[model samples]
Target chain A: MTLEASFGTSKIGADNIGVNCGTMLYNEVKQFRINHSIAEGKIKMENQVTLKLNYPLNEYVAQNELKLQFSEGTTLGDLFLKEGIPSDSVGFAVLNDTMLHLNYRLQNGDFIRVFPLVNGG
Target chain B: MKWYYGKLLRVNLAEKSYTVDEIPEELFTNYLGGRGLGSYLLLEHVQADIDPLSEENKVIFTNGFTTGTSMFGSSRYAVFSKSPQTGLFGEATSGGKVAPALHSTGYDAIILEGASAAPVYLEINDREVIFHSAEHLWGKETYETEDTVLREVNTPKAQAVVIGPAGENLVSFACIENNYWHSAGRSGIGAVLGSKKVKALVFYGESKTSVVNPELLQELMKEMAATGKDHAGVKAYRRLGTTQMVAAMNAAKAFPNRYWRDAYYSHWEKISGETLLENFEVKPTACPKCFISCSKKTTVKTGRHKGLTIEGPEYETIFVFGGLCLIPELDEIIYLNDLCDRLGMDTITAGNLIGLVMEAGQLGRIPVKLEYGDVEGAAQLLRDIADRRGVGQVLARGIKEAAKEWGLEDLAIHVKGMEPAGYDPRPLKGMGLAYATSSRGACHLRASFYKPELSGMIDRKTTQGKAEMLIDWENRLTIFNTGTLCQFFRDLLEWPNVERLVYAITGLEYHKDKLSEIANQIVTNTRIFNAREGATKQEDTLPPRFFKEPVNNGQDRITVEELQFMVDEYYKLRGWDDSGYPVHEEG
Candidate 1:
């Protein structure tokens, strides 16, 4: 899971894969063109990993997603602490397809989906 | 009983008349309300050996002290009867806007007894019951019937609980529709109503349940509001609804895919909650007097089935149709969900029966041929089941009859003739015990032990101490039902809150031990009823496939040894003998 996404302009959404690169997707991504957003003066971040915050968390981040460049070997807990997210507030997290705990180390170019606790039937 | 009207409305369909009886304070004192109260009333009024669909069978509707109050999840109701589906103790609960209305009709509970000579509906206002001819509405779907009744009653703020064609046909899994979308959705309660020739019941009133300590209630409300505003559960539910389980369960590899042939679906992303929000025009819908709008009113905006809308395809519906039957498209699942709602059928049971048929067709065990993911074919079969045509006729009798008829008894996954919800109990070993010993046929909600297992609250594969935890959760949830509160508020409504709420509402404080005692007693009462109907250890076991098949090609499958360990422990802990019967309890 090394970083492979390019600085392209295609927007990713839903379950659709990002066409700009071969392996990057931020489903529910409104405008996640990393370099393109930076070039357009939308955001200034050096991180390669994207965190798509679902609800309440988005309020804390002031937006739907955050681009954080994590230190090598950084765990999910490290990233959440850096981003000011309370670990207890998080119900569950998914990195791509697998459910990963907070102790799981972050992979480069990872698209993490974090949501609060939902009472499932 | 300052908080309660302490009244029972008994309607005799045979005579088209009603009577309001003074309910004993001692009854409420012992059983609380909702499930406990209703079950006691059921046992007292109806014989255990009577056919569930016969006129002698009684349908009891109940609400708690919190209902019609300022409680957050108060707009929920419970229906208790002998199940036409399982031929055992039957109970179904739902959250909607109906409970408050029904509660306001100035009674703690209502009982419908005897069968009418023709199709009829009842109009219930404050202290009055009006019988009406429902002959014209006998065949209408639940939504249309509700709308017509609401209009015909023409009373301000009136609500109707109605049944559809499936109920009229006495489909064993038919459910009573409420809020036009939500259902007291399991146990064939609608079939009970239909057998009594009752098409619908209307409720309306301004009467309210008095609070024992209004100031204390307000204080608790203030504290709750302050803390719940930022609660993760609230944010999550308001955002994604229960459909989020599709992602969590799928990601954990705990999902049941392709009628248990697989553990996870390849096309899961297409039907996940995120995908549904991403693809469909989903609007969050809430019941009356609630803030967490967890129900998704989704509409197809782009496909050929565009503009089609339904209140949900909840996690259970998605798991059954999308996971089991392999309906890949979310919109198609929504379509089938709408179909079940309109027909007044329980989606879980309907999808399960259809999935069984699909498995049968795939194996060439039946004359009909339908494949997995064949949306049209499944839809046709669903219609057939509701209409009681050919194979549908057999299925309308229930899974027990259908599986026996198709000679696929080994393949059919059920307990006590009722199918399970989304989770595959084989892998979640605790769920195995849950399904086997639920008293109401393979019910998930009795404990919803999947929540603990899937969320890592306990070891998923271990049976050690599982019975202890399962009983804890089940007893607490029984209190939840006795409160008539929605299960979504389980996180927010902690035991302390429950204590205070009960104190404020009933002028009685329910400590954990006291609550557990009441819950255990209530469950044991239901067990006694089941035992009287000939239930035994055999009925309290999982299906054979669970013991043999491993899910997802993994080693997470359950063994009869493991399930028996938990069952024995559960029974022992409940003070029951090795036979799974209560030792010292009275029926």
Candidate 2:
């Protein structure tokens, strides 16, 4: 789904503060090129993955769900950086409904869910 | 004497008289203040067998020794009474301007006794106490009552704690709202206030507390702020408030859903903190002097509930209303939250009751056709309960009594008459034990064992070592609650800091060990009080659901045999007898 459709772009624009989704897209493009070159010899093909970002965290991505292509060994941490999610903002992550570390390698057809940092009673 | 105001205000509404009594220095040394002192006073004044809604049942509002001082997260006060719902020791703490206002009134505690002949409010301005007729304010919502009280008292800066119509109508889970949003919102403390015919407490004071070591306090406050800002938990709380837990808890399969029938909510993301910030949150708010602003001011900008501004549908509210009731719409959750606040009812109990009613209807146990996901019906029921109308009358009694009356005791999800918070204990063993043994019944805050469990400080799936960990947590929280500090600062405030703060404020030397001893003493005393009220080992238990039902898609389950083992281990750790009574050491 398009970012606008998933996040309701109007509501996002009104609430978006320090987050710049446009810049994040540009950075992701740049990083993808670099990773593609680095993995050219190591891996044969790109891995398609589905990512879901839960709220507050979604503010950074401006989309609830994203389908992206990544290098075979690309870590969730790399995806977070490419998506403009500050390391400090992430509380935990789930991969295919299981808790995973940021270093977890992205697999083809894998689904990852990102949660924002929070604490309460 | 430096930190403490060294006085308590005693008001007998029946006689319409007020008196200022000097606080014994020994009381501070023994009980510290806030929850500890309040518990002591409850045992002393309130009879164990007295009906909680009777005039004989005393309600004590107390600030900690460090409360109103320059200590970080010290802006809290405790409201202790015999719980109209649980019939046990009931205490709820709230943050905002009220504790500081109470502290500035030159009293460490304010004890209200005897029912007023009519609705009345007590106004405390420094040394003076004025009893004002509250006939006009009685049935108003909490926010409106606070505004009216402040206007009538003619003190713009004064803080007021008022109850809404639910309390006046004697809804068993009624809460006392302060500063419009903050509430001592558990254990039916508001009903106790209602029983005494108290409409509001308006406090205004300019009196400043004397600090024994001002320089040390200043240094400590700075250090605390600096450390708190760098703390990970504090940062998370500031950014996402408690809403952060929605995704994480759901992922961990610990978040309660559908009245504990499920551990996961598929629509959790739609009702999470992120969603709230995106759709409704206007700004972040905090209690007085708190570095971490975990509270939110939210407003609906569009749709049917447009322009509805409320302080929060905090983590608990979201869990209860959103997850428990299957209400996926954030606007509906926010509206219901506002309704509960305006009606002056505990959202946890209110939502739990609705969930119970819905479950009962599904089982054909009740004639009502209420169903899960019926947000409008739930909101109507909240209002009805506040007004004590029809089915609402039965529900207004809370889940325990209502379920008992319906003869559906097994379906009521509560411990000691008080409903559990969001966490499903079936997945978290320590929380199960904590809920079962909590003095106030099914409370998470009394000992937030979920933190340790979820954070991997201990095994969440195992009962091994949980009993000892629970004992430690209970003692630690006893100190924190008695210190009257916000639990949000648990990571920042340590034992040494507590001791140093106490020494700096009170000029009384207290080691970490001494504080632990005091905490143990207070906990033991509370147990004794419960024992006197006929609580036994049996009462210290989770409901049948935890034992009989499995959570996490049936991946995890707690057995009755396992819970009994934990209870036995906990009682032994507490030095309680087999019957769960505290063992006294003879000199």
Candidate 3:
């Protein structure tokens, strides 16, 4: 069953943080969303769910955030593993300002921001 | 046999005499050392019902099993006594050369008992203990006291733990300071030290503990040094130190600024780690035998306080002054940190009390005209607290007393009369349990459960499995305290490394399970000590405001029911009664 979802074009992009750790990857990143292909009816939104990913995770693919798509109900843990990200790499994921667990099931058109795990400080 | 000193030095200040008691291997086998052994000694020596400020309350200094060895993060010692602040079981640990220095004195534990007739200091060189007049050093700041003591002792490479004016004044949150900045900086241990009327204890000796397996310990230390350099936690700390926590906690919407009226500070970046690096002259340094070097020896470069320097305004310090008091300037925060260090007061408690004063000013609860972001005012107030004058006199008694006298008890944020660390328990519910159930009051280091929660090892909101995970984290960290390893090494020393270090260093014939039992017993022992001090389930709770106020747009809050649920589960898991007292088990 396909759940109809309304998606918006996002202006969100990579933040230029002058974090002094010298360990972070600075990527030329931007937010990604579906290209309004639904009006052109060139895409089926049932099986494939398009979502936006952020840097650290995006550093691996070096692609637009919206270009990544997965099947419906994909968990964050599965997405991290599928992207070849180390299990301990990401600190947390935020969807619309709500912090997410790795077990959170991904929804279609969700824009998530993932951060690095910084602790012991 | 090896690595275990199996000796305790007991000093009677009243008689100005000392004696060496032989410890049994069985005691070392049961209680590892440092916090574990210190807890056991506190029970055996100090009576439960004595006034914390009385001479009947004994102060103990202990080194860990691996201390004075080649182990990384081993430069730490634990102080145990009845907390003058909480009037309950008290323990504080510090990292510096003091650990190995005290270890060199040829004793596992040094117990200071009885009050002296006049101010005095002790010089201990191996088995020799000399009593020296400290009437001149009595009023000096911690740094000058150390300089003067080392000058008088005539012992090269000697390190001394000294109490400053706040301690001399019997401020309930006074801390014992060493190396000018490193402090056993909590639990009112300094007051207990002061109550003994002894000014300082210098440790200098050539003795070294022979470990059971030097080659294996050497190999483990090598692996730690090699891997720790590239470790993410190590690198972050090496670069920015704990000051990075300001931004991270603020970003999580749990920075607890303006006396926790607001969880998020708008100008957090102004006083953050990045700002500290950009604005100050910082040189990364470390304790002896440590590679992580998480401490930043910072000096003010361009400010009113220029030329002032200190080891850190650690994360807890920043949170209290920068976050709680709303000091937007990192330089000012560093200055406050230095003030507390010199005064021999705990910055967390001092800043917290000052933050409360600012809140009362704002709330019209008190006549003081202080306000948030008042750096100069906070500095002056710190001096006042040390001298025990006016409002400082009330606050000198600690928040539990000061809050009531000012009719601000309802507004104070504390558990068991102690302030919480940077992580507000509201947003992170596991930290709620961490604070509520910690033997020490609202302590973060006990579990550092915030690490697991913030890192997404567990959902921060859920209380379902939090108790079990919190116990696991607390139990493991109890070993860190027992082993007296730095908490920063949690990433480097896993269960296997802990087992290997314990086996090689102490030869305890232990693994994770056996060591965990020792850790549990230590925790239970502390709980039993608190119980004897009249603490009940009522004390194992957060301030009312935490439960009532929902942070982050009302999205994050821990209800009384939620906290009670976790607390109940924590007590059950620790084998404590419904009243939160652990069942005592004889080793």
Candidate 4:
């Protein structure tokens, strides 16, 4: 099991991801994984990963950076949880320009995008 | 005569008479507009200890000085009365095109008095006012009533405030539906209108609200539209709507779960905003001149509740009807919102009462069976309640009375007979205190803490100075409502723009210090009006649940003692004796 992550200009690790899931979200996601058995596969992280963010709607990927590893069969919500962002904050998740669900499993070469419900119109 | 028409529309329902009365210049200067006007008028007119739903009660609708102008997000209005829910001073506001319409109709506010002998609707178009027969439209739903009125008047874009079957049946929590979807949703003012036999009120005016300083106004608007994009909360609201708060609050352990017995829900992902977009229809709607359009025009696509249409199953309704009741189904919640919309009911009150019913059922106090997540049962029961049929009659009396009738008074979750909003106070300790001591009672919008909780508008867990924070928010919000600006405008306007915008419109140049004084004056007058209505420090206290029982989870259990200390600190900050009432210093 391996994972990678990046946020902003900083890079943390290529083997593990960090998420500070609040008690409410923790209980729910914990129960969800247990019921679905999604964790039985080879998708565990050994070190923290880095996810970059910018203003507006940009994802954390570059053409050459696609082979960085740590993104095998992971869900958008799981990625957000790994990064300490709440699941609700990710209003819409996109992978390769297509809208993906929190339950959408990630592939190795996929670029992930997350948008929050910032404010109402 | 720039922004304000500087006049009040006075309607005596008993006599079926209406007139335009000039407002005093001194009144506008001291009180400002909208909420400020409501406070001054309430102090001058309404008495304490009267039945809140009686003819003696007065319902005043007021717009701010900038209401009808070109100022962005300046089209909100306030409704003031002695709340039937809290039995204290109540102020509920809404964002729509109506406030500016009132201003264009040559009035700053409309004050309605006495009960009508029969159901009637009032129409105001500039100088002309007419009371028409609403007998044919009395039984219509809120949206239907507005549609009928729009067709009759032949005005495609007119706005209205109308009630539903819930109001007709005197459901204490029923709201006055505005702009079809917006609502003055708290304190059961709809029941007051029902008691008066009034059906709806419509206003239409094409005249522009003038600005004293055009250049300054233009600069302010430009500044607002620019900086507004920087606000994180505004951005989230724009993208995800209020539904985004569900995930954030759930993560922060602030979302109330299972009738406040828990802080977290295990099925949150299924009901989260991300999931809602995946499962339901989400469209965008906005108030007049507002860029932050948070309202989601929703349509249920599946299940027995298919084709249900509603403006929002906002975070509050979603939490209350969905998570609070253990029903994580998004479509069920959307249908419930539509039901409440058609019934002209307040989701806050309805959700609270339904939670009470679930609590009662859990305790085996009521013979009738009910359970959390019973969406169909809840819907049927809601229908019964709105029509005052059987158990519905008991439920329509509100949580306090229903609890009393069932002989399980302690099961009711309320403060001063008002139900708490979407957030569970036990987990978010400061919010519990905020709800208990709210001037209107158990309302969260009085000063929502999610900004502080999630985004760092203030500190979340720090109760040490949260009281001062609450006061600051309430005071600033008072000025916001008085200025007739939308809450979203805070993203763009800030305090400086508030002063600049007002000065530009009214031609009254007041220093920043004078603006603070005006804000404080509005607060003091509102407090004094409550005092006249017999509201005291003791009325400001949390429900028995938060104080008596310890809401426990994996970690961070909260008890009554912790909440008590916060309440004490809050009262101290509010300048009240231990009780949380406004303390008057003798001159």
Candidate 5:
């Protein structure tokens, strides 16, 4: 299971500082790169999906003991639903402690964390 | 006659006479309500040139049109008069149950004129209004007066507006404390009340308000409450209250330590929201119909200050007492807030005055041994300031005057004789412009930019296009204050929805930006009043410190030249000249 992101590296707008982690929208990642290609030599899933991997799995989710898995071509919303998390309940998502939208699609081997709302003024 | 109670209650304390007069409808519409109404009426009805503390001067307490209703955050009333500090338009507002209680007593406003020979308190319950001798309440703390009035009135729900020993002694920065915690905390309004020999005003009524559209208003109320409760902005306040600001400000290196001499403190984290909640959090206080319970009730848990309990150290208090004074001890900041609250003085100014003393001591302006972060020394100074004793008498005159008397004029950190709030203007340049030209002098509530600037609502570093945005906000804020709606609404509710809400309730035809225009007219009218009273464009300038001293490490460093450029742009956007005077030519 992997999740990859695009444009989350730039702290550009209000949406960039999301409450938690993971890209909320898969389309944002798609737009971040003009062409999409999945990384090779990973767990081969289904035909309709592809995986793009970044960073080693051992270094992911540092300082927290939690198990999270992602599916290729899976939307952030779809991945959360698979984890039994409600769509309306979460305000932001993160791939690596950076904020993203739920509509973001997951690439292979990208560790992600979903977060609730941000209310700090 | 029914709508307005058909009369203004004019109390003349010097001659001990009271009069009632029918105020015109146009005047009411033009000013709207609250601070706008009070300022307009004071500027028009009272002589402008008189001394602020003179017998001829008047103090006007006004409630907005929506007050006493089930409207969310409608429980705000304003006190307007000439300030003994600025000698300009002095206006300050407070929120509690008091506004609704006063509004229920069949009056739009209470105008206190002249001066009393003896201390007195006003009691208005139902259809009756009476003046009682307040000799026993004189020199009493504000919280004690509120307690005594609420008990003696036999109404636990009665709202009491009280002044402390500071006001009784006529401290120029005196504030009026309402419901023990909420305060009309700026512009020296409490001193004005004290000068007239008034100690407190207590009121309670069983009356209900009648609006133009009851059904629509009910729906709007439900919506507004829900919105206020759920808004991220409002929720933040509810979560940490104003103390939430400490983290953000500290991160930005804008924490004005020791009167802007330093930007960081070693124990900054000890006085933050997390720390406050960990150390002292007993309960929460809320305004009328407001679910965002941002106010805190705190009690000391340990040490020499143990057992001391107070309602707050709201952002302004936390900033002035903790950040500005470089005192990172939460208990000490809480103690200072409690002292200022009970004393009926503006905590920001009180803290600023203490900062001046610290800076002066360092510079050898004062022979006494005063040092930054000295909580005990500062506590003693608070006592002296409240009683106007010894050196406290000089401090009681306010920071601007105190600095002059101490020969530390360059160290004074105020614009137009009012202390700057927590944020140093250098980091947020627009606020520098706001402080310089604010009609009521250096005030944060008049316009707060930190909410948008730091919260990613606007680009904090960009000063390119903020002039128009600031002007628009200033005008709109005037509408909210006058309409008696909470400023907290702007984050979630759009202006059109706000207009719809007001129109649905009051049946007023103000549409879209029309409310803003009406607000502009009110602001313009105020400026005109000041103009006639001899205010000049030259006076619309920041304190010398703001332009002269740049914060040592903050990212934003606005020079005097840069500030002038922004103010010039702001003047142009406001239809004013380079000198900050309103342009007379019609568009």
Candidate 6:
């Protein structure tokens, strides 16, 4: 659960954030993968994950499902910035069925869903 | 006199007489209109302890001060009466063409008193009130009733608010249906109408209200519409309607799943707004004079319920019939929604009752064979309840009375005999207080605190700072109700804009402080009415389940003591005593 700060490198070793790895480990392993193209200027596709955007969020994402590549230590805040979604516009996030904070580090093969800052009764 | 008609139509059904009475100017200045005016009239006219279904009870339909004007989101009307279900104050607001129609009839409100010897309907054309025999329409569904009334009236533009078999049978949660779609659907107002033996109130009028500053009102309305166009919340509502909340609520763990037992529904996507857009033909619909069309008209084209058209299975309807019942099929949910609308029943309370029956049956408290996810069985039960046949008779009494009769009172998920809307209060603590203190049983619209709590604007986990926020929201929403403006436009209408609208409509330039004082007075008046009706601090509480059980697998929980602390703070903020009674100033 620990997010490493090193860029272009697979620092996927420790559980620093105390995530419940026992249940999420299988989904992580199945979805996570690393592409080591060291010959190509060290462009690490190690944290490639799938993103699902629900209504209103999808209006910004332009699609319901997206496959995006994030830097190894990228958090939701970084991903939202890269994707041009205002951080303040996001109400909540769920990564692989577990609710996560904006600062939670993205893992390879992780599935993230972002919801807009909207509510109804 | 510009915004308001300053008159009410009084219909005495028992004597088959109708009269027009002038509304007091002081009452309008103090209470404004809509729910405020309706509540005031009800409190003054209806006896405190009379049976809601008795001949002595009164039903008042009130138009908002801005209703029928060129103001943004002003197409809403409030219906107030003593609830046959809760034996407390009952008020329900609806948006459609009916509000403007009623307003155009040259009346600020319509008061129905006494019971008719036979079923009848009223036709109001400007100031003329004509009583029509509704013998043929008595047992018809809402759609059929509206069609018949319109055909009989011979006016294509005539708008009728009619009750279906559910109301005729006096089901405790029956709702009044307008335009064969929209409903004032809570607290058994329809049942009260049923008791009066009135089938419909038809209006066919071309009259218009004069505004103080028409040009300025139009300019402000355009600006408000433009502001709404840029709002993210309005965009979401227009795109998916309220159904958009399914995914977000599930993510936040505020969704009520499986009769409030779980915080999340695993098959939520099947019933989410995305699924509706993907699978159905959704046509965006708007109320009269509304630019922000947030309602959806959907048609099921490829399912067992194919060819079924519905105005909405809005967020609450979807959660109640789909998530709470654990029914993953969207088609079935849409079918159930249509059934409730046609039967003139409140889908929230009806679905909650079904869920309770299923749970009670599982717990061996009842011999009923209903189980979770029984879509067909649930549909049949709804019809039976509307007709008051067999088990339907027991259920027509509502969950509180029904559960108590079956000795399963602890299992019912309700407050003051009204079922809570879709949000699970354990995760959103402010909603817990909102539900407990809402003037009409468990409702979200009374004060939609979830908007701030779920959007990260307020800390949902803490009880601190919630009382002040809740009071502020309640005041703002109370004004919205009195203004008769739709709550969807709340974000677009800031305080300054509201002051301007008031001036533009009524020529009464109220300052910000004046508006605030008016809102507080309205809230206090409603509280005093409830107190007179025997509501106490002890009745302001959540069900035992919220305190005893945890949601999201023990991740979110609120103890009874914590809820009490919040309630106490809320009372103090509202200038009420510790017992939650409104304190009055001595002369």
Top-DockQ structure, candidate number: 6
The runs of at least 3 residues in candidate 3 whose Cα sits more than 4 Å from the true structure, single-residue gaps closed, are A1-85, A103-115, B583-587
Query: Clashes in each model (backbone N, CA, C under 3 Å)?
Result: 1, 2, 1, 31, 23, 4
lDDT of 1 by residue, B446-550 (tens): 988877775557767789999999999898888888878888877777678877888888888778888889889889888888998989999999888878888
Candidate 5, residues B1-587, lDDT tens digits: the string is 23244346777777766776777777655666765677678767677588888887788888776787777777778788888878788888887778888887666778888888899988876666778889999989998998987777777557889999998898999999998878888988899899989999887777654677778878876777776654545655676777766755665455677877765555778888778888775577788777777677888898778999887778778878787777888888888888889888998889988888888888788976678889989889999998999889998988777778878777787887888887767766777777777877777766576555543344545677667767777876787778666666555456766676667656777775677777776776666656656788776777776666666544456676776776788778766656666643221
- Please state the CAPRI-style docking class of candidate 1: acceptable
Comparing 3 and 6 by TM-score, which wins?
Answer: 6
- Residue B503, candidate 3: Cα error in Å is 1.1
lDDT of 5 at B258: 80
Whose TM-score is higher: candidate 1's or candidate 2's? 1
Candidate with better lDDT, 4 vs 6? 6
Give the chain A TM-score for each candidate: 0.59, 0.61, 0.51, 0.44, 0.41, 0.62
What stretches of model 1 exceed 4 Å from their correct place? A1-79, A93-115, B584-587
- Judging by DockQ, tell me the better candidate of 2 and 5: 2
lDDT assessment of candidate 2:
0.82
lDDT of 4 by residue, B385-451 (tens): 8899999998888877887888876667787778887777765666776787676778776666544
Interface RMS for model 1: 2.5
Interface RMSD of each: 2.5, 3.5, 3.3, 8.7, 9.5, 2.1
Worst 10 residues of 4 chain B by lDDT: B450-459
Task: Give the per-residue lDDT of model 6 (tens digit) for B201-256.
Answer: 89878777788899889889888777776666777888888898888888878889
Docking class of 6: acceptable
